[model samples]
Target: MFEFSLRQVALCGQQPWEEPGELAEPPSDLAAVIGTNGDQFRDSFTRLCLYLARTYDDAPQTRTDDTVVIGTEYGNTEALTRLQLGALADGKMLSAKHFPNATSSSASAFVNIGIGATGRNLTLNAGLLTPVIAIWQALYALAADRSSTSKVLVGDVYSAEALLDAKREANGLRCRSGLTHATFVKGREFRADFDFTADHEAVVTLGAQIGSDKSIDRNGAFVTADFLDVIQKLDVGEQSVLTCRGPLARRGALTVTRQNFDTVGNGGLGE
Candidate 1:
C-alpha cells in the first residue's frame, strides 16, 4: 500500500541500495567530515532536497505556502561540537548560527530551502509516533481546509562531529549520528506513472528504529509502510515475524496505497 526510501551504514561493506528518485548522487564531503555543524547540517539537507527534486521534478519556484514536516532524535550536534576558546568563549557551548536549527525541525528548514518554499513549519519531539503523527497532522491541516497543496517532509538528522570521545563526556548521547527519513505527500492527487500490479507487492518488511522513531516496509502484492516504534517484518504468511536492525545513517520509509472499483466508483485502498 506504500512505497519506501531508506539510507543507512553497514557492517559488511554496507547494504546494497539505490536511491530510486533524485538521491542517486552522493553528498559533497559526506564521506569526509569537514565544515561546522551548521554547514554539515545544511549539507545534509541539501543532499535530501536534491534527491527529492530529482524524484519529484520540483523546480525552484516551489513556494512556501505548502508545508514541511520534519523529525529527528537529535539535532545540530555539530554546532554543539564547537570548542570553547578564551574566557569569552568558555560558556558558549553551541554555535549561534546552528542554534536555530538545533531542534528536530532543521530538516524541514532544509526542505523549504531546497524547494524555495514559503510554507508553514512544524517540528516535534522524537518518538515512535512522531513521523506518523506528523503525517496525520499534515492531513488534518488540509482536511480542516487550511491549504489546497500540502507537502509533508518527514525525517531525522543527528550530529556527526559530536561523536568524539571527549565530547561524549560533555554532551552524552546528543552527538551520535541518528537516522534521517523523509517523503512527500500531496492532497487528493497522485503522481503519474504510478501503476500497481501483482509485481508490485513486497514480502519481507524492512525496518529502521531509534529512540521513539521507527519505520517498516512490508513486502508483497499487498504492502504498506508501518511507522511504529517496534516494526517487526511480517513473514511470508501473516503473523510470522522476522526482524533486522538498520544502520545509523540517512534512513527513510514510504508507501503508496491505491484502490480500484468495478462499479460506479466507490472504494478504499486495499491493505
Candidate 2:
C-alpha cells in the first residue's frame, strides 16, 4: 500500500461553448512563468490549465520539486481540428503557435513549465479512467523515493471541442468540458492502491469495503473531480475512500484521512 497526504485541490468546469471573453485573465506572474500574454490561446483546455496553475502557484504549500501528471480523453482537439481545416482550405499551414498545442501533453507541459517542477512529469490517456489512473501514478512516484518531499499535481482536462467530439463519437455518451487538479504528498495517514482484474466481482468486493456511502461509481468525466470534492470535505481524523474501475478491468483505489497536523513530524508526513 502507498500512503500520501492531500495538500491542495482545484477544479474548473467550463460551461458548454463558454465565450473566451468571460474567462478570467491569467495573473501577470502566471503569464510570465508560462511565457504567454494571457490571450495567446483561445482553447478552453489550455485556458483551464492556466487557471488551475495560477491557483497552484498561489498556494503556500506548493513545492518546487512537485511532479505534474495530467490525464485527458481528447486533448486540444480544437487546435488539431483547426489546423486540419485551415490546411485543407488553402493548402498552407496554420499559425505555428497552434502546432505545439496540438499534442495531448501540451496542457500539462504548460503546467509543469509554469510551476517549475523538476520531478517526474507525465500525461496519460485511459478514456474515462484517466484521472484515477493519474492519481495512482502520482502516488506511486512519491513512493518510489522515500526521501522526496515533493507533492504531485494530478489533473485532467477536456476541451469544449473534445467533449463535443466525444459525445458524437461515443453514441451520445455524456461528456463534460472541465478540468480538475489535486496536489498530494507522501504520508502515512492515507492508503493508495491499484489492482488489475477482469472479474467484476473483485471490484465490487473492494468497492464495498471502501464503503458505498463514500464510493463514487465511474459515471462520467468528473470522477476525479467528485473524488476531490469528497477529500476536501473530510474532517480531521476522518477518512474516506473512492474506487474506480477502468474499461480494461483495472481498478484504482484511494483512501484519504485528514490527520492532525500537530501529530505530523518535522519531515512533513513522509514517515
lDDT per residue for candidate 1 within 18-99, as digits (tens), equals 3111223344444332224445445443344334432333444545465555543333333333332222466554556544
Per-residue lDDT tens digits for candidate 2, residues 1-271, read 6777666565555344543222343334544544445344435566556556656534434546666777665655655666577678998766676645666567666666666666777777765456567777788778887324343333334445554454454332334345666666766645555654454564333221233653222223345656656655666778676665544455665566665442332221110
- C-alpha lDDT values of all predictions: 0.34, 0.54
lDDT of 2 at 188: 61
**Prediction 2 global C-alpha lDDT:** 0.54
Clashes of each: 24, 0
Best by TM-score: 2
Candidate 1 lDDT: 0.34
